[model samples]
Target: MSNTGLMIFDGEVLRSIDISLPELQHNITGAQLLEISESKVSKSLSGLTLPPNLKNAAVSQVSDGDDVTFRRTEFNQQQASEKLGVFISAVADTLRDAPVVVSVLDGSMLKMFLEDEDDFAMLAENLFTDLDEEDKGKLCKREIRNALVHMGVDMGVPPLSEFPILDDIIKKHDADGDEELGQAQFAQLLQPVLQEIADVLHEKPVTIVQNVEIFTGSRLRKILADEKTLKCLVTKTILELSNEKDSQGRADPIKTLILSNGKELGLPPLSSENEPVALLYETIFSQLNNRDKQTAADASTEDGLMDSLKDILRKFEDLLETAPVYSATNI
Candidate 1:
């Protein structure tokens, strides 16, 4: 699975935030955390944006209705930071634990198609012709299931896998029987079956978790803006390189580092199997090679390596800004 843009509260993301230490030194209240407005907290956060769908869930987790600890509490800078960090972490946890983003199949499309007389007539005729193999005017009632499949999910019909009610719906119409049906009988069976599906969907919309890679660069941009966080990342990368004994290659270290940490930095997962991501890396690395011949040599030092990583990340950000990627997930 690809990384989700939704923030999964981590120490790294919490540390990246730049909050006013002094502002949080006063006596705190559970109702208002550190005098920080939701908007301010949101802005201070790095590498995390709370999407609208998740706002309510996050807010609900921010409080537990117990204020005994925070009432009339005065804390030092470290304590204040810790307190605020706890709250932020809770919000992130809520978002992460909540369901992945989903699309609701509420039968609106099917209703619209049914409402249009010309469209429904054409659709029925087409389905009849397709199912009537051997050019026979009649078809087995079992073909009604095929008709439903022909309509598919695009017409607001859920897959049998996603919506098991479809089987029951088909059975209710006796469409499972082998009784022969002419064009009119087939259309008659189809219309009511579709109508019933639409009614069921109207009562309980099917939520489909789309498998997609959303690369808006918002998280990446936030990470890039946090100088302290960038410095910390560089320092950690250097230590990892030293421990792994991976200093021989020029740009290879950077490439490996990025491929490993791209998801954390809000880029799509980079692997050989994912062509779009692979091509992105190829293009960026190609440019890096052409522009800086001494990149390999520069990897010997800390500052030089940091500069190279920043450059590569900036290229990714720019590219993503121009063309964001999204895909539908099958649940």
Candidate 2:
């Protein structure tokens, strides 16, 4: 895993980063700071650094929503430099507190195996043996696709769905045909196919997001730790719920509010309809006293609403830390 993807974050490394304008440049804008901060962080997470796609996504996710401090469009030279420092420090602090896990497939591992004669020979021999199941010294060339599947992500071979170029590579070599090949012939056919994939990957790496639930309660904890952010979220949800009332004139349930905003608060999204997630919410809601439920339902003032939201969020923080929930699909 370490060899296949850039490790997520190194707090010490991130904290030590010094952000500034290029030599002779005096000023910077919010957008430029964002670019510099992202570049520095990406560089620090070297080796298997985040591909452009993931890096851009992460930057947008972090800055666009609740963390709006980085969105200021302009600043004088001194202010820009100071704000840049502050933004980088905040990024370091947040990630150090709860780092997001990610993986990248850059095809370097395949290149390594292809470059080493002995390693490539052994890899070919092993693959041939695996595909040859019956001790028949020959295998149909079409088995090349299966061989790539067997190599999988760890070996730097992307899935057919992820990299359609592989299918083209196979057809180009006529390896998808029914022609049979012996061990040496198989090696000959595989070498060029792998080389082509490595070249393609060098140009365009894929960032893979595992679809596993995060049970760390990190997002919930972060929001809970910041009273201002938590209050803002509660206020925002309340307004949204009010605007989203049904034709019957009934406001959405507090539970619905929780479900709708789950992902932001470190729980699973409501759209998953995952049974375990539904059950978890049911358990939490069911256990709340009738008076507590009534209070949450009837609350109209900001303080009352905030208290109810805090209680519910605290429950989520505890339960999510104990159980996994559905997350976004892996890509």
- The collision pairs in model 1 are 210-329, 211-329, 250-296
TM-score, cand. 2 vs. native:
0.44
How well is each residue in 61-177 modelled by candidate 2, as lDDT tens digits? 545543466565666766655656665666566555545455577879998999899999999999999999999999999998899999987788878876888888999988898
Off by over 4 Å in 1: 1-156, 159-168, 176-209, 227-229, 239-251, 271-275, 327-331
Off by over 4 Å in 2: 1-8, 23-29, 47-72, 99-122, 125-146, 158-184, 195-331
Task: Give the Cα-based TM-score of candidate 1 against the true structure.
Answer: 0.48
How many backbone clashes does every candidate have?
3, 1
On TM-score, the leading prediction is 1
lDDT by residue (tens digit), candidate 1, 216-266: 555677778887876776777777777764445424557666766775666
